[model samples]
Target chain A: MTLAVLDGGTYYHQEAIYGERLGGRFDRTIYAPELTAADLAGCDALMVADRIHPGVLRGKRPILLDYLVGGGTLIVLGENSAQQWAPGVSWEFRPTNFWWWLEQGGDPGHRIVAPDHELFRHVGMKELVWHYHGLLTPPPGATSLVDITPDGDPQGKGGSILYDHCHVGGGAGRMIVTTLDPFYHHGSFFMPAASRFLGKLLDWTDEAFRTPG
Target chain B: MIDAILLDCEQSETGAQALITDLALGPRIDLVPFYDLERTVLSRTRALLLGLHSDQRYLASRRGQLEAFLGGGGTIVVCGHIGHPFLAELSPFQPIHGYRVDDLVVNREADHPVWAGVDPADLSKRRGVAGFYGRGSNPPPPGARIINSLGPSRCPVDFDCRPAVGGRLLVHAGADLWGYFGSGNSSERIMPQLFDWIAKPSEAA
Candidate 1:
């Protein structure tokens, strides 16, 4: 279950998250600009971390798509504009309500749509409650794991925050996309929830890769 | 001559991207990608704007070039927590603990053009929520003049340092100063005024 994370070499990515904090857990830190097909080879799970320049990854779309088609799990973090490069992914930008927590009895309105999913076993809804950048409308047959409703109503119209999609188009691989930017905040040493979520999420990614379904 | 060169990392935040777009509109500003810093000529550049998303490791590797630029009287503006050691003059960012809104309040330490039209209260909070301007301090080095402090404790949130013989540094322990844009307050004047201050080399403190 080799895990390879795309490193944009930002201070947050290189100094805080991958370089020091969670450096031991990752098998490879592939520099985003130097990413090639050979870099993805033998990698079971590849994570495109949040805030990586879209232009850097967009050029490697062919390499990434080929990895997915070749049965490699792909994890796309938030705020990376996946819609611009990812096939079948529809992304809509949302103004982040940074002050939502300041409101009386305020909640970010994040809901776990798939509580019974294995990913939930590692991370609960509370870990995903921080503000989000946007919503992802995953392709057909994709199972939405978490969502956020504007009205704070669990049954109200909402957008997916986390989703899982099996590559039914041409491969046995899968993709996990989330609008939550744990890496950015965690790496920046700002949000504690992001750190907790990242630790648990990494645990889940490691476990899921080991027990491939 | 270009007023400043911003190292653009293409950070995904809406506000950051908006700030970049706004800065791009400035006639004398050059927005270069962060990866190209090594090859980008900085001899004639007035200042280097390093954002929260800057690759500090890469900067550290090019410390010589940066020092040379600064030695030539270049001004470098850094925004965000200093997680890694890029310049010897900058220390790692220290986060404030058990902070309240009062602790996040930015106080002026001196009068300067950068802080001229900007209000301290407006920089403290945005729409009633505080801590947007800063969460910690970079801990200014010796001989550096503190421009702004946080709360009564006066933790240095903004300061000016002369790291090299003729270099100048404006370090802020928060997101880029341009993050103040669209706040609907006097704080909006910071980004433009900062560049104006830079353009006036005679005013270099």
Candidate 2:
């Protein structure tokens, strides 16, 4: 399966996408500003990661929508504001608790709701412990994979940290989005969990491409 | 007078928004997208502030322009790990393995205006949590004044390098220095004092 990753040219994106660990996994790395439908041809999936300028994505919205409608997968990572560029994605901002783990009997509040899902077959709850940017409520037909209880609520009322949306753009394609920014932490050499999560996510995508629908 | 030209990567992250807000309130820093640096006029600018989220690969590709700016007596302050060889003097960031709180300590090596009245302990921890300042080292260029070091090895995490033939360069191997704004601590002194230091005429001048 051919995978195309958008390159924002940021140091973190450069290291995460093209660095030693997962560089060989990507089939293409298109410069974000110059992205066109032609640039995504023959690729099974295109990933839009964190820290990409929303303006650039807004400019390429038409091309992205076209790709989605053309039966190609579009994966958007966190902190890029999917609502600004992707179709039918609703994002709401919430204050992140970066110091939750430091609190007494504290919990970061992340859990894999869809534990049996193929995406979590390799990556697990332990790998998604870092703080998230916000909550995502995708349009109907979206499946929430990861859920987080806001403010460490004992009631467990929260939003999805990761989700998979089907029939996006009214096509056979799909979009997988998550508010967790693994690449930023992985590339920064912080948060060992981010590295493990990213590596496993890449493996999952590659495996998904190989399996016939 | 303009304090500096911040290379904006246009990210919507909280830290990025905070930096933007801080600069907007000051109105002295010009926000230029990283991609637009090639076309932006910089010869007259006194300093360039490169954030932790900057596109270092793009910066490396446009190294000539940056070198020219520095050669023309322009300062460049970079905050973050140097993953790519963007500038000749910078090396890739090396992370400390199995580090302790002491390793994260901010050791003041020399006095400078940018760090005036800033307590090392305050810079060392944020809200009683340590390791928020820095945990790695971006080896400074030779002859650079080590302003702050981290860990027992005294790895240089912050330094001021005045290349023999160019203006000054300040490198901070951690979060953006400007993000410290409104933190109600001496770290808050960094943004304003940094610009003040940049505006001052060098001894050569």
**Candidate 1 chain B least-lDDT 10 residues:** B11-20
Candidate 1: regions farther than 4 A off: A14-24, A36-41, A102-109, A150-157, A210-213, B12-25, B97-102
Top model by DockQ, which number?
Answer: 2
Give the lowest summed-lDDT range of ten residues in model 2 chain B. Answer: B11-20
Interface RMSD of each: 2.4, 1.8
Q: What C-alpha lDDT, on a 0 to 100 scale, does residue A146 get in candidate 1?
A: 89
lDDT of 2 at B145: 87
Q: Rate the local accuracy (lDDT) of all candidates.
A: 0.80, 0.80
Tens-place lDDT per residue, model 2, A1-213, is: 788888776767877987776676677889887798899889889988777877788889999988988898988998777888888788877676676677625566676777788898778867787777778775798888887766553334568778999887568889999887887887777777788888889888778763333
Residue-wise C-alpha lDDT for candidate 1, range B72-173, written one tens digit per residue: 888889988786778878998777776887888999998888889788989887787777788779988888888999998998899987785567888988
Misplaced by over 4 Å in model 2 are A20-23, A150-157, A210-213, B13-25, B203-205
Residue B204 displacement in candidate 1 (angstroms): 3.9
Q: How accurately is candidate 2 docked according to DockQ?
A: 0.62
